[model samples]
Target: MSNLQAVLKQYWGYDQFRPVQEEAIRSVLEGNDTLLLLPTGGGKSICFQVPVMTMEGVCIVVTPLIALMKDQVEQLKRRDISAAAIHSGMNRHEIDITLDNCIHGQTKFLYVSPERLRTEIMIERTKQMKVCLLAVDEAHCISAWGYDFRPSYLLISEFRLLIPKVPVMALTATATEQVQIDIIDKLEMKPVRVFRQSFARANLSYSTFLEENKERKLLQILKNVPGTAIVYVRTRKRTKELADWLTKQGLRAAGYNAGLPFKERSDRQTAWLKNQVRVVVATNAFGMGIDKPDVRAVVHFDLPDNLEAYYQEAGRAGRDEKKAFAVALFNKIDLEDLAENVEKKYPAMDVLRRVYQSLANYYKIHVGGGEFSAYDFDIQNFTGTFGLIVNETHYALKLLEEEGFIQLSENFNNPARLHFEVDNRQLYDFQIRNPEFDTFVKLLLRIYGGELFTEYVRISESELAQIYFVPELEILKKLSFLKERGIADYEPRRDKPQLTFLTPRYDAALLPLNVFEIERRRERDRQKARAVIQYASNKNRCRTILLLEYFNEMDGKDCGVCDVCLKNKKNEPRPEIDEELGNQILHYLKSFGAVTPRALSQIFENVAEKPFLQTLRYLIDEEIINYDQVGKLTLNSKYHS
Candidate 1:
């Protein structure tokens, strides 16, 4: 037996390991705290998957995204591996069974949300389980200092204390040096092995275009490129529109969004991955835990929130490592719109409180009544009725949830799954005894079991429907039936896009909040928006360089294959331009004090085509235009001289 071949063939059906997968697996099997820093689509799962089989106990993977946990467990179960997840979405029975199973080591991998580790039941059960390793996915979220902060992540350290000997492996696609340090400090893992794969993708090419006809550019790509593609947009509305546009342009494409019923999204994603649908136009909500290797391209219709998110999203392409393309198309107006969107999202305390109050009234909530209540939130529906921007209103709702005013149905946020070992005949007989379980049993019959028997599964009505030939509403109905029956427990799902309302009674002045933390979060969101803008607008550095620097890696050589480097030359300075374009740039400098490449392009919109680009290139070559490290331009010293 090749050392790595035992479980790889017995369980996973892989002949050999991808670059570092074997080493990572060996480290963990050797009982070490291993941090695997692989690029997105670098087979992060197998590192943990391989060792779980060799070990004699359960391997608990702490994941942040409910969908991600569900998808992973689903895939594992497909391969006959036993796994399950315990997260916020499930009812008490589901969690109890999963936890009990973990305790008995019936499950190999038991998935749980970071927040679940904080719960009394989870912690108590975790104490009993013979844990092989504590795998933390999206490990960067634990850092309140990082771009995305979840207070629930703070509970991870508590789990660390619960199982002192259990090794912890924290994994994320994009974490800067600061975020990485915070993950180690926050988790307090001593003597961990930090494994990093090179961030560079030699087979992929990067290109960013400021095009007026963004959709047309996308269409052109679809027409020219062959194989599966993922086009990312910023919102649900855009996901729909772009998908339709691509399909109309003769590309077999579909939309994926958080607002989509889980079933439809799953079917569409499946079709795309199976090569039935040639393209998938989706919001950023898609692409986590997706393992389509032959994707020909990843097209960004809007700027991403940060270099980290962008890298992970873009990395979704070319997973088979045959040549693939990553393209970001933007306009100046989108950048402006992005900034305004940021301002609206970080609403004032009064605005947040007011929105909370409105939600309570809408739901007819009263004091001490939030404990067992559930509500469905519609962004356009709720915001329009309340006279608020949907973006801003959603942000306020999230804050309310964090303050423990009320629990929200995280949009399809089933972090865990629950199932039992009842015989099919028993389940059917129970349906006769308990007619309510009928639909749920029918639904259960449609699914292949991994989540229930192996580990936990993610619970989402719509996602379940996609695997079967059923409607999304029917899927929800079955789960709802199970939830009500007390025989089966299912998570209260936000299968479609939604914001959960917290607090039984929302009062304007009485809600307890950390003023500094709220403001700090607001600042962090703004910083992310700026990063989104900067990534789309920057024209000076190699796309690869911009990403590497963001991750705190310096003194790195450029990837000569990217658009910026290949279109020009390696490390060659920018060009100088003639007077008219230089004058227009100077005028922009005088007007805005400083302007971005995208911002500057907007100022001379009257000029046809690439005139401004040609002019700017000349000015840059002449050293008449000077840009900062972040690509903010100013009047060059030599321009005045």
Candidate 2:
């Protein structure tokens, strides 16, 4: 076996590759630029991961989400592979050490944010390292036609120029044909090998339930389906409220959102993964890095902003190849609400510029200052003070961030950080002098490794409290005491989102808002909104067919199990029973023997279809007639000559 194949077996325990995985791996190994258009749960990572294991040097993976990067790096480590990630949440020293590891240590993969590619440290260090491959996760974000575009992603092409020999492999779970072409052109992929798996998912039964009381329908669905499920809502408040409602209904459930502390989110996610919780009611933040395979249902409590997001979310169901459902509960009010949301999401360029200037002013940053500075952001306070609508202000800030002027990270519960200030001898001497703090200090040294002496380590106060059988607050106070004594440096975690300036502050009047680009994106969003609305309101076509057609697949067959197909089947006319038709059916059966439903329909030329079917069914039910194993009509013995 080839080394790559052997490595894949060793790591993933798979004897063979999925549809396009082997081909993609081969393309990358051949030093050709490849774009993998795999669906969610299609194992896009394996296509790049397996090839990296076979080759030498580090693989640089540029991704957008910090949580996802960490999750992937952790998974790689669990498989005994060397990997590390650098994101905005990490302090400069932590990032510096991680980069140093990539350059000098035995690290095989380095996951970084797109913005980090432009940093001086990264630029200088990566030049010294041997980079084998460039893998861009969520490559669609580089295209305007994509649903989520980040201006920082465009910087990837310039970075590629610095290492012209390294082949680029872009992968995304969701992308249209236009987005695919745009990815190739934007990333400057040469002689690209495009691998697209069909977007159709036959295991997922897509349905829409139209009811004024969506909560009621949701409860009914949960009761009927009886497996793990996810209910997606738009706002963070609804996530908690709906989760409470589900709990009241006596199902183990939890709310997941960006606002929760990191520890709470981790606990809830672990509970859900372990089947301790039956459902997770959450916003869009909940599902990106989750890999649950037995989720029987994924319901949309509110209308999604676009079809791309909707498809990716709904596709989370039926990953185990078992029967599952993707349901959307909507009312007429939801349609109106969606329109308003679209307007709020795409504020005018002037509003975006105003929000930018206000942010700078809020941070007390001058026009020529604030380069690469991080500021704690309170959305409610900022909006209230400026008299700006909360939703509009949030959306405006997101647009500004996407334009590369600033980088915004929502509330991610980064753990508290600690590093020892004194070496072992001095700390031991201090511990001997202060016996009250000795046990705690000893625990810190024992639990965290010696790395705490050189760099900060993310420490868990709750874990410490559990170990010592004390309150978390007590542990925090002890840590504070140690820090005050100059034994260690500690930084507690923040519970709010942060905004970092990507460039020095620019004057508000000449902030360079791309008017044409912004307007074009707004139009695209409008089109996407209309498409999703149409998908929900549609009652004639199969839901699967509609979704497939939107992704440019016209050859998809009708999924005979969707709500529309089932309703149509229920409405189809059926033949009725009558004495005259009954006699005719019996006589024809006696003469010609058994016939199939289609043939019987054709034989009764004078009789209407439904009436003929009704007669045939009635005779069979009466025992005066019957059909043989092969469906041949037969008279009972009493009627036989």
Candidate 3:
């Protein structure tokens, strides 16, 4: 047992690595900068994680997704590995403690967002740590040609200078060849080894349907395919509407979107994962970092903007290597909407400036301030107050984020947290001095234990209220008083989207928006949307081959199970229908007076279905056989006489 295998077994309880996984891990362990291109559910995390465990210093992972960062950190901790993440929502104290742990070698894995890499504190602390590996997840985001181009990812190269000797591993599930080249060039990876798993999903059958009544078609599809499924929609409203409709139709389903309360979302997700809900009707926000391997079908209710996103989302199914279906239902209206969305995504420059100015005013940030400050942003209130259209305002904010002026995070639930500021002895003294709070303090200690004294612990005020036999408001008041008295550090829960100013606030007219880059991006998006339209509208090409070719996989063969392939098979010319076969069918009808198609088929069981059906058609067209009012085949009266 080698060290890599030993580490994998100890942590993951796996006897071996998935295909291409061990080789990728070996490349990283050999101290070479590596680029790993594995499809969704390819276990990319383990490639860097297992090797980092064998190395001497902490591995720094840079990702753009805060949700994924938190998920991975919690997963690592479950395996008893020391891991921490620093992102935009963290307070100064939280960042300080997390970085300190990394520097002091108390943390083995440190996950930070790309924006955090440029922070002075992050830079200084990273230099102090003995960094072994620098892993860039979603590395394609650094590429301007990538579908999801984040300007903040460009700062990673500058951060790389601080840990020059550390081997870098860039990993992404979906990246075109152009984007792949850009990632390496942008990151300045030298002597790089690239490991690309083939993008073809042999087990998944990709199919598209042009339907006039999509709701009926969708229901029919769900009935045809069994097991767990995902029904993806374009809007949050549709998620609930469709899920409720599915339930009314006697299917166990639930709606999931980012806007739902965190607990409800969590509950729905848990129910889906456990198969308590057979289908999850959701938006695109549902599937990141979720690993349910037995999803038998992923049905798209609308066309995505690009093949990259569609591929990633559809690839979520059949991860357990079983045969699954990825069905896309689209109509003419969807294609038009997709085409129009390209223009809508890039709001006019004037609208962009207006939105920026409105955001600054809403946050009460004067010019030359608000740098690095994050605020809870309510988009509805902001647009309503400023008399702006919500859709246009959202696009403007997205444009600003893409241009690096601000960072807009999805609505997230930050639970209430507590940490004791005093030592156990001091806490006891405080409890004695403030005798009124003695019982509550004791209950906290009894319920949460000693970890709350050393670190911030997630606490539920409602649960505490239930336990203490008091109203939830009383629990909140007591927690606030404890913080006021400096007995404990209590942070109340927050559930809102965050908007952080990446740079200082600027006057609306002099914002220096990158018009040329924006134009190029708009063109890129238009091209992507056109490709999506073509994919959905195309009738000649194999769906799997089209997707593979889009990703630059030229050697893909036609998946025989796709709708196109099956239709082509049906239409393929077969041996000409034999006259003897036609005569035999007519003679049978004459001898029996009338016979059902099923009985006739059984009599010609040795013949193929296509050829037999063709013979029957020939006989009927020539008036040799006909169907009676009872719908049974019989010889024509003229022939019988």
Off by more than 4 A, model 3: 446-449, 572-641
Better of 1 and 3 by TM-score: 3
Q: What tens digits encode model 2's per-residue C-alpha lDDT throughout 1-641?
A: 87777988999998888888999999999999999987788889999999999888999999988778978988998899989888766777677767777887568999998988999999999998899999999998999989889888999999998889999999998887898888999899998998878887867888997899999999999999989999999989999999999999999989999888777888999999999999999999988878899999999999898888999999899888677999999999998888777677777878887898888878999998987788778899998888888878888988887788988878454668897878989988998999998888878878997878765677989899999999999999999998898888788876668788988899988998888888888888888889889999999999988988888778988887788987886687744569877877778777877677678777788787677767776676456886665766678768767
Tens digits of lDDT, candidate 3, 1-641: 98899999999999988899999999998999999999998999999999999999899999887789878988999999999887777778767877888888889999988888888899888889999999999998998789889988999889999988889999999999999999999999999999989888877988999999998998998999999999999989999999999999999999999888888999999999999999999999899988899999999998888899999999999999877999999988999999899999999999999999999889899999988898888889999999999999989998999999998877476779888888989999998899999999999999999877656777999999999999999999999999998888898987788888988899999999889999999999999999998888888989988988888999988887788987886787744788888878878777888989999999999988998998897687455887776889889899886
The number of the candidate with the highest TM-score is 3
- Tell me the spans in candidate 2 whose CA falls farther than 4 Å from its real position: 418-445, 450-456, 465-490, 568-641
Q: Which stretches of candidate 1 lie over 4 Å from their true place?
A: 361-374, 384-389, 399-508, 525-528, 569-641
> For residue 499, what is the lDDT in candidate 3?
88
* Candidate 1 accuracy as TM-score: 0.76
User: What is each predicted model's overall lDDT from 0 to 1?
Assistant: 0.74, 0.86, 0.90
lDDT of 1 by residue, 1-641 (tens): 78578778877777878888888888888788888888998878888878778778988888766678878988988998877876544567657877888888678998876656766787788788898888888888877556556666777887788888888888877788878888898888788788888788877888888999998888888788888889999888888888887777777889888777766877998898788998888887788778888998999888876677788889988987777999999998888887777667666888878887787777777754654344556767777887987767777776676555544544374333455445456566778997755665666655635445443455555567787668988777766666565545555544544333322464557877777886776777677778767767777778887777777778667776678877667355644445676676777676567678787777777776466787876665455776765678777765554
Between prediction 1 and prediction 2, the one with superior lDDT is 2
Deviation in angstroms for 413 in model 2?
Answer: 1.9
Q: Model 3 shows how many backbone clashes?
A: 0
Roughly what TM-score does model 2 have, to 2 decimal places? 0.84
